[model samples]
Target: MQFRHSLTRCSAAAAVVLLGLAPGLPAAAASSSTIGVAAGANLEGISVYDTADVLNDEKIKDALSSIDFNEPTKVAVFSRQGEYSDDINSETLAFAREEHPEWISQDAEDYGDYWADGYFIITLSVEGHGDGQIGTYFGEDRKVSTSQMESIHEAGYEDFNLSRWTDGVIAVGAKGAKIMNRPWYKNPALWITTGVAGGAAGATGLVVLGVRASRRKEFEANLSTGREHLSNVTMDLDTTELSARTLPTGSRHAADLERRFADFMAKYRTLFARQQELEAATKKTRSSGSGVALSKDFIDTAQQLDATDDAIIAAAALYTRSATWQEAWRAQTAPILEDLAELPELLGGPDKKLGPAGSALRSFADTAQQEVQAVGTDLAAQVIDVDTALDRLSELRKQLTERLDAYAAARIGAYAKSEAEEKQMRAKLRKQRYASTGTRSGGSILDVTSPAEFFWRVSAFNIGYQSAVKAVNSSRQAASSSSGVSTGYSGGGSFSGAGGSSRF
Candidate 1:
């Protein structure tokens, strides 16, 4: 049963600002450094094995959201239908079979969904089928569903469970990793998938680069360290401006500027603590389910903070440039500017000579004066740059708070619209479920009393019960091939082998 949901756009700003990432203002002094190389780019492959139960589990779905296989990441996403044991007997099985004739049976009662594009493996007796455990096995051991899960645990990885669908998928990916990590000849499946195994019929397989939990942890730590360093550098620059303002004219020196920078560096340790606090607060707000207002406030505040931090970092760069100019003026250029002031006096004095030395001296004075003035102008400009960045950060923080307030005011209307959408979705699902299954009469499939419903259900059962099951190519054929055409994995299979090899 397919539920077509029409989510009326009640508030575009609410939709865009709340659902998507808040619009970000680039940090005035933001560096062009990449956050970190995404591991997904180097991922060998990805596979999603969804047992029927997983479709109804929201937590599992949310966990799987981060692993996108459709993009150009090295990880190929494979969608596979996994089997779960339900206590439906022969009559129910026969009815379901009659409805979708193309689906094959893995056991006396278990139905297998087939697809041509990817590797498929049938694993029966997966640990939780009767007794709750997790494993997968291939070839002759394919009947043993627990084979894969057990092998993974035996290899020192964590035990797999259907509840952690994402983890199970990762485990399946590790099998591909073991294959892909091998030498070329040893990985014929990769050769075939990448078009190297020409005319090889059974070479369809995936090359997964499964990231271990440890690697993910390490990547996160490295990312956090990078952010901290960046924030500290920004704060250091801001503090340098404070000292720069206090420096008397002609007293500025490279040593003094560096000393101030060093002082700020000492003070930088506490900024990391503040950052961690903000992160903790944001996480708490998200987990609390405090509605859109709180969530939006946290997001807006976090963005503003990030912008402020970047500006501070940018200011530091500008401040450093200013300090360099200040140092040059005090050490060398100040003397030139002073000498240029005396040039008019020297030229007007009684002993003024029109010799080469006198002409050279006038020329030197002229050039030195310009250089000194240029250095002053450059330094002033850098100061402005730092001040402007700081000002922008202040303004951005103010704007975000105001925007969040407005969003909160309008949140009630948005919630009402969303509730209406949900109601419509539920109504559609109810209509389809009862219309197709005929009201779950007497809590038994054999007891369906409506002649019209019975005939339609029986027709669906007939289609699914066919013995010789093959991959149906067209959408039309696939529709009749399943009991509830759009309810499960109908028209969802695409070619790109991702799991254990399946021979049709």
Candidate 2:
């Protein structure tokens, strides 16, 4: 979705006059100490223009100052309030061009959408309270996995929803730093370079000897945490396996659980062996007093073991949810039935007070209800497969959302009185939707008063049957991916298809 376009570039003074925005960006003063360590000068290149005046500039600067990066990196946070091009990436890039041309490089050989070799942009646009889009464009040097990007967004989106402007901005920046900045232990490149420059044997002898003890202590501390997490997961596996053994003989759920448990247990045994090897190696290294750098390959295997816990949790929840599914199916379906029954009332009854559209809506609802109920009957009889049932239920949910949104669009405004009210209503509806299934979905289909407000809702009505579909699909990822995060993306951009409307 990347586009190539050149914008009208302007100098800072003319751009300010034309755009009518004061720079307002504070220079990050160099500090010898910050947050109990040396404050990074890396964020000193950060340009935060709170042009919307919603954020506390000083607070944001303070948060940014506390963070550091592995390289010279520049970040910009642009908070704007108004009608935008709906594509935040495009708008943000355009902002960089017209407002801060210095951020984008004029050298054709060096770039595409990214302004420079080490710059990134985060743009937030709000049209009304509780509504806005947050978009990020990353430079190659600052690129992250989609999972990491989501983690960053998760850290801030709720705050934005709550109108904690300062907190949200700070959270986004802080999370970005945490992800982009590699801790000394996690970064193998530094170790490899050091080992090569100095002798590979006991590279600790090359630097200050004090560093060896500290590094060893840090590694052990991290290893202890990993062991704790691994132990808890191991216990969970034990409990689940014991439960599986106790299931009724020939139970289908038991078979499924047993299969997954066998696969997981095999991997778990390997991890335990590797863990023992690591402990043995550490003891040897300590006894030798050589301060040798051990192979970090174990770190990867350790991470893989930690990720296995996600799959175990998913399998357990699936087993538990499947056992009592009938009750949940009935509860979730009841709301849809109620909504269908209330459709005629909403459209001014059987006399067609709302006319042809109302009649068409009723016809659509009737057809959907009949189809969904037939699928439900099959579900009750255990004749319908899970995938097929999910498909039908998901289709029904979509139609209901489209139809209801249409009807609401043609009818009243003010579904919410304020941003706070909109959030409250959406949260309450979401709660009702997932109460039986134990899953929460994002989005709103409430035909809210402002377009911006709908952004916060995730564009759906999670109040009825969709929750059932979500309840299963939600855990599917956890069950499938060991890391519980998506894998792979194009080198050119963020998401899998290299998404967003930023220009090259």
Off by over 4 Å in 1: 1-389, 408-412, 415-504
For all predicted structures, in order, the TM-scores are: 0.17, 0.34
Q: Model 1 Cα RMSD, Å?
A: 33.8
Q: Model 1: per-residue lDDT, tens digit, 280-336?
A: 554333233332244333333333333333332333334455544344224323223
Task: Give the per-residue lDDT digits (tens) of candidate 2, residues 1-504.
Answer: 122222323332333343333356322211223222445656646677877878787777777877765556787789887564355555566676678876666567654444555766676677667666665656666777666666666677788888887787778777777676454333345436534755755555656466666667755654565566557557666654655454443544334445545666777777677567557665446333342333233444444444444333433333355674555455435535656776655555333554554666779778978987898788777687544554566566556656655544332223433454444444554565333222121111111111222211112333322342344344454544422222232242522221132110
Best-fitting candidate, measured by lDDT? 2
Alpha-carbon lDDT of model 2: 0.53
TM accuracy, model 2:
0.34
The model with the greatest TM-score is 2
